[model samples]
Target: MKSIAVKNIKGRPARSVILVVISMLLTFAIFGGTMVISSLDSGLSALENRLGADIMVVPFEATTQKKFDDIVLQNAPGYFYMDNARVQQVLEREGIAQASEQFFLASASASCCSVAVQIIGYDPETDFTITPWIKKSYSDSLGELDVVVGNDLNAFVGDTISFYGVDCKVAAKLDKTGTGFDTAVFTTKDTIKRLIQSSVDLGMNIFGKVDPENTVSCIMINAAAGFTPEEVVNDINLHVKNVKAIQSKELISGVSDSLGGVSGIIRVLICAVWILGVVILLLAFTMSVNERRKEFAVLRVAGAARSRLAGIVLGEALMICIIGSILGVLLGFAVILPFNGVIEQALGLPFLLPGAGRCAGYALASLLLCTLSGTLAAAVSALRISRIDTGVILRGDN
Candidate 1:
């Protein structure tokens, strides 16, 4: 029975093949876009979860010209300085398990290329968050004046960087972090202090090595196990001075939600591609069925039950769907391959490219759904063939 169906389709397969190709193309484009975006979201969510820190404490007094609350909460670019001594003070508080400090050095233009580096001044000994990633990516070589550049930093490991008139060696290149950190440069607190004291061609006074005293831009706190984040933030806000502690969940969600405009546009474009593909497929299938009315009628007259005839119609559609879907998936990946690096750099994020197993699964799922729809449509159309009077149709037709 299947052989007969195959032979029948082979008689005039152009339209059927075209419909399948169009349907597959649409499904691939829509799902592919969604998958890529979801991968990015997953990577970011993972980073946030792994950090395990309950709150971020940034200097509220750093920006005297502007509102400190607005700068920290709204993500305005500014330098806020808090006494380095507060690191121990925060840790001494009840329910605070540990605390880490970070110094943010703003971006500056260079002679060759313009780039922004978020110089994270971390205590290499105490920073558990980066130590593991750094150890896995590098050995004991990452040191002062030897920086770990983010994957998207647009510079190589051996590249020479002159910031604030202090030259540094790019010790290692990081894998794409898929966050603001990806565009950042990491170093010790003392090194960043020196860089600020020196003057660069841009005339920006970023480092201050003048005084023995120093301040940090922010403090990240890890709550003791079993302590709630809200309780932690409340406790800090009440006891801590000149700084605000924000919960991690709230901060990451705020950033992701703020990207709604960009996400919405991509979703809209995906829907449009799907709609256009379906329209093309529907037209092609309808035309194919019309041209084969005589064939369907003949089958009905030749001891083929209406249900069996319907299955054959659906089978033909399914065959085309499966083939087209496979082709479309291959084509989609081919399209994404060329721009993978640029996409990672521009977005300051890492990409989770689907492996063969994942791609195969996605292709199979897409084909199954499209085939089911095509089968149902063909089944309905085949019913019309059953209603026709075979004698009248056959006799009237040439």
Candidate 2:
């Protein structure tokens, strides 16, 4: 019976090819759409956790807003400085629990440091953010000459990274954060101070006479109990001078909005593709069944049961679905895995693909769905042909 079904499919090569293509398209839409949406959701969640701060404070310059968004949202490497006194001011605000000063230094094009890398200097003694996360891999404090490279960096532990001629050892590498931090280089405030001095000595002078001891690029703050991030941000903005405080939630909300728009478009495209696939499959199957009516009637006359006829039709559909779905899933992964970096860069957002188990689950689900759709498309014709009177069909009656 299965052999008959296979021969029937092979007999109508164009119809079989069309059905397979439709099934493949449906599977591709399901698998690819789910993968992208799932990855974006995971990446955004990781970004929120990795930030670990309620608010970020930066200098109130003309382009500060754009710069902040670039660094945080787009992961663009940048360097901006403000007086260290702003950190103290933020800490003094009501409902503020702790504030850590951070220094930013951009490597010059010809500097020994990695080109265009954002060097972030954190105060280990007062920091409540990056340190705790780093403890997941290394328990000890970061040494003056020791640095933790972001996961995206090319260097590994024990590898020395030169910053303006001062070589700093990579103490450890951070986990992937799916944010700017993943590409950033982190060290103690004291270490950055030395790097600045080295740069000046080497005549790099990227920031020209800026005193690292008195300057900081940003402040990361945590709210005390009974204080909300929004409240802390408002208080800091009101009390602090020459700086801006941004609530983490505000930035996250903006990113979420952008993601929602993109996700909506993807969902719409997936639905359209799925509907078109189903329509094409239905038309192809209908035509195929019409052409095979005489063959089905012959089988009925030969003592083949109606159920057997239906089975043959469904078997052909099942075969097409299985092969097409597997091809589509492989194609989906082939596109997603190799070009993930390019996707992330183009999207300018955090993106983390689903793990192996989740990916397998999605593939299975897609296969099942494609099979069901194919079966339904074939079942309509199967039922119609099965219910017809074999005598009338054989006698050539309309």
- Candidate 2 local Cα displacement, residue 246, angstroms: 1.0
lDDT of each: 0.64, 0.81
Candidate 1 lDDT at 138 equals 69
Please give the lDDT score at residue 334 for candidate 2: 93
Top TM-score hit: 2
Error of 1 at 258 (Å): 4.3
Could you tell me the C-alpha RMSD of candidate 2 in Å? 2.3
Cα-lDDT of candidate 2: 0.81
Q: Which pairs in model 2 have colliding backbones?
A: none
Over 4 Å off in model 1, which ranges? 1-14, 50-52, 61-79, 85-89, 112-115, 199-203, 206-213, 258-287, 299-308, 337-360, 383-389, 396-398
lDDT of 2 by residue, 161-183 (tens): 88898888999998876667778
Residue lDDT tens for model 1, 1-398: 45666886677666656676676777677557765665566555645743446788765555354544333332223455667666556656777777777665655665522454556656675675666676656677466777777766787878878776678888888765455445567776667666555433345744443231466777778888888778888887788776677787776565466445446766898778766666666566666767777877788788888777667766776777667766767676776656755664555443445556766676666666655655555565566655667677678787
Best by lDDT: 2
